[model samples]
Target: MELEQDLMVSERKKKPFRWHVLVFLAPAVIVYTMIMILPLAETLRFSFFQRDTITQAISFVGLENYIKLFFDPYWVEPFLNSLWNNCYFFLIHMLVQNPIGILIAALLSMVHLPGKKLYRIAIFMPTLLSFVVVGFVWKLMLSPLWGVSKGLMKSVGVGSWYLPFLGKEETALTTLSLISVWQFIGIPMMLIYAALLSIPDEVIEAAECDGVTGISQFFKIKLVLILPTIGIISILTFVGNFNAFDLIYTTQGPLAGPNFSTDLLGTILYRTFYGQQLQPGDPNMGAAIATVMFFIILTGVAIYLFFIQRKLTRYEM
Candidate 1:
């Protein structure tokens, strides 16, 4: 009874305060709230209001702008176009970029490859350059007048298929998507490569002893282990693709030209927020668009977290 009473008394004592810990977090918290949260809150506020064109008067309009965005044919048409285009862009990345990345990483992960460092560098070099550089470089090369792409096509005996890809409605979006893929393929390759490298050699040796070799070892063992990494990359790709603007803007301008065939949400937001040839800039409408985008992204993240992420098993190394 005496020993138990002593233990209870000790446990009842209050823990020491740590005020110093707050100093480390204070700077980051304040900066993030100011930079990210503040702007987001302000944008949200703007979305529920309306501003008159002539008088420049502001008034609360509730969901009017949002309704217009979705139901008003003039607005809904462009909005839907951008949304579908964005989805297609993301789907292409999921299909093309990721598979190619997996293939390259699988190859690079194997031993005894010569000049592997050089190959890695060559693959990743485009990612290091600015969107401006990559966009302009490709644009110039693909220009009909320059004839670089034409010349190469001719040499390969497929010159007849060559056209001004960037200026055509049918090819503009796909051409840009491929360009984006080429620039960013390095990221997934490196991520998947790192994940593969981190797998335990002991695990591999055990699998080998059990006669799990060649493609069987890769598919049954290596691929399964790296699934969590793939999940992270997928979510990252989703967020990045939705937020993409720099490349399109730099290459095709804010109009996302060739009849807006390549127009995405980012470009649409830009054109709306800043005023294009016909539409005057309306902060309220712009804010409404932005608010909708935030929810769309949030929904995607939620689905990924609750559904896809839970399905993947994380193995302890």
Candidate 2:
């Protein structure tokens, strides 16, 4: 009798099932499944099969396309070049943009900075512009005949240093990377600034009580606490960099310009699937490249999730 009464009491204590909650969530869940999940699944499925060009017959090719991608000279060279360029692109963001963002964020997070709001708006303004607009504007600004960059350089007595940056094979990719960095640095800065803002006032007060001040306080207290935000931004940067195409396509064209110096995996994938000029498009081969890129990005995400994210200490407020 006692056991029965206890069981009844525990059952009563449990909250009643809320079927209406599911009703509220149903639209979003259904839409996400249709929009995101279905497309990705179909893309993955397409990668495994070979498609006939004439009859439009599709057949299972197993790993034949992937094997070709690895060993074929034409595929291998361009694939490797794009891969290297992507690594360099990511490296520039990680090394140059991230540090500068942190610096700017740290400066902005100061309690009483004059025109801080205006500064933030100005810094982040580029990020709000369309990639096409930014690309075209920069292209014109950098053009020698247009003289924006050349005039600026002359003002600094370095007009002779002006070169056709986008036209040069060696400098083209680096210039694009820098342009991308300039546009996106605001993301990391804003994220880091928000992280800094979330720190408890008590923590900073305690640090000040302990004679911690200025840069030392920022380094020891604020920066340490914002590691999780930094990690999140890093992973976001990785994904954005790997999927980068719009700006490159807008600025440099599908050919990736100057003997393919700025070619990236996304641009390659685009060219492969759609064809360019005399070279015919190969959908099956393009799917293989897409599959490779998917795996590469998936691998990076897995490593970050399982390894790096695990190491980050999530502090309780």
Candidate 3:
């Protein structure tokens, strides 16, 4: 009995560490913690502090930066404008990108479609191109002076309809939003395509048995099944749009020009953090803006997790 008890105790105490799991996770955890987490935490911490412009001294000032961001006329006007522009950008992507993606995905999912791989490659190829390249190319293409877009429009009997889209305040943001949509639409297409393909053969066969076919079948069955994926795509679009800086910066410069018509939160943040031509860099204010962005993204993610995800019922495959 004593020997058995001792053996049992020894066995219980002999806990082996899962070294393999730690080994696999260590690299990713270390990298993420070092890069993402540390930077984010530092930004948040910095936001609560203030810097003296004249004396060049830093001091703790809880919420003053945020208060100024919300209230000060110097900051509030551009902030609101950028916020609205960001929303418009996101709305365009949601309306144009996702639907087109779904349509393309549905078409590609068709069994008898020829050269599906070729079509997929063509649609997705632009996504792999650098943003700088895309922006520069699009800028040249849209240039009213000598752009091929103008020639193409004239070829299609619409030469008079061509406008300098990127040069006008009214059209700049919308035009850039459309350009962004064109670049990233393939993401939603591929994701929705995968989701559509993942729908079991059994479910599809059952749907067909009930005289459901063609567009009716797609709307009734496939669309319903891919709601979760669409939701995911929507959230991703929101995050990406809010975080957007590269293409806008590459195309419109730090001012997000056409009279700041194309300004977004990201562009504003960059300008604030790094300083524009006349304005000096303010790290504290930049950190505060970044914190706001973080919360905005967090709120969106939280909504999706707590409300949207709960509502979206995942059908078991």
Candidate 4:
């Protein structure tokens, strides 16, 4: 009976001290729930209701807002255009940014690179600046009046190629996407670099012993180990790109000017929620757009988690 009592006491003593964990986590949880989740849920709820113009009375609209958004030609065209443009923007980042980031990170990881710290700092410096700052700076640099890009192109004997990229409908979206990539490339580089650093030196040395050196070593060893990190970076990129707003807003203005050439989902949401010069504000429609965006982002994340991530094996090394 004494042994049993002692064992019970020991088990009680061994129980985790959850109070400290709760104390540490409570503030962040409360803040996140209040600020993000609650507001998001409220927005979703608001999408199903309509407000009266005269009495400002609200009434349940079922899927009326969604139906109008899809079936109505006026709203449907711009919404689809913005959706497609957003997808293109995301595709550009995935193709250009990730590869460039990986290359930069791989170069930085080289043991004997001269002034490596300086290079890293210089590369990462752009990412620290606000989206507004990046957008304005790039806008000025690309401005035909400023002639900075033209001068550089002239120096490279490609002066004829210099054009008002931002003003042209043909090139505006791609230009904006590339500008975004330039500013944010540091993120993936830092992530991949950290993943590379986490790798055991002994494992790399063993690969070297087995005649795996240079690019061969990176592909066969480092690449395999960093697959999990790459997967994480990809998902994060998807979320960030889908949610992107500030840079486009600052650079192209709320109208996404030059015949709405650069209109993205973020800009579309802005125009919908807040009245533009030509278009009137529709809060219910805005909510519906927001809901659609939320679902699109959720779908992308789900695909990544279930399909892409499952195939990526994170090795113990």
Best by lDDT: 3
Worst 10 residues of 1 by lDDT: 11-20
Which numbered prediction scores highest in TM-score against the true structure?
3
lDDT of 1 by residue, 1-317 (tens): 99999888887775566677998899999999999999999999899999877888998989999999999999999999999999999999999999899889999988666888888899999989999999999999999989999999999999999999999999998899999999999999999999999999999999999999999999999999999888888888999989889999999999998888999999899889999998788778999999998998989899899998999988998
lDDT of 4 by residue, 30-72 (tens): 9999999999999899999988878889999899899988999
RMSD of each: 2.0, 2.6, 2.0, 2.5
lDDT of 3 by residue, 61-141 (tens): 999999999999999999999999999999999999999999999999995667899999999988999999999999999
What's the true lDDT of residue 1 in model 2?
100
What overall lDDT, based on C-alpha atoms, would model 3 receive against the true structure?
0.95
Misplaced by over 4 Å in model 3 are 1-9, 16-24
**Best-to-worst TM-score order:** 3, 1, 4, 2
Show where candidate 2 strays beyond 4 Å.
1-22, 53-56
Residue 257 accuracy (lDDT) in model 4: 76
- Of 1 and 2, which scores higher on TM-score? 1
TM-score of 1: 0.94
Decoy 3 TM-score against native: 0.95
Candidate with more favorable, higher TM-score: 3 or 4: 3
Clashes of 1: 0
Better of 1 and 2 by lDDT: 1
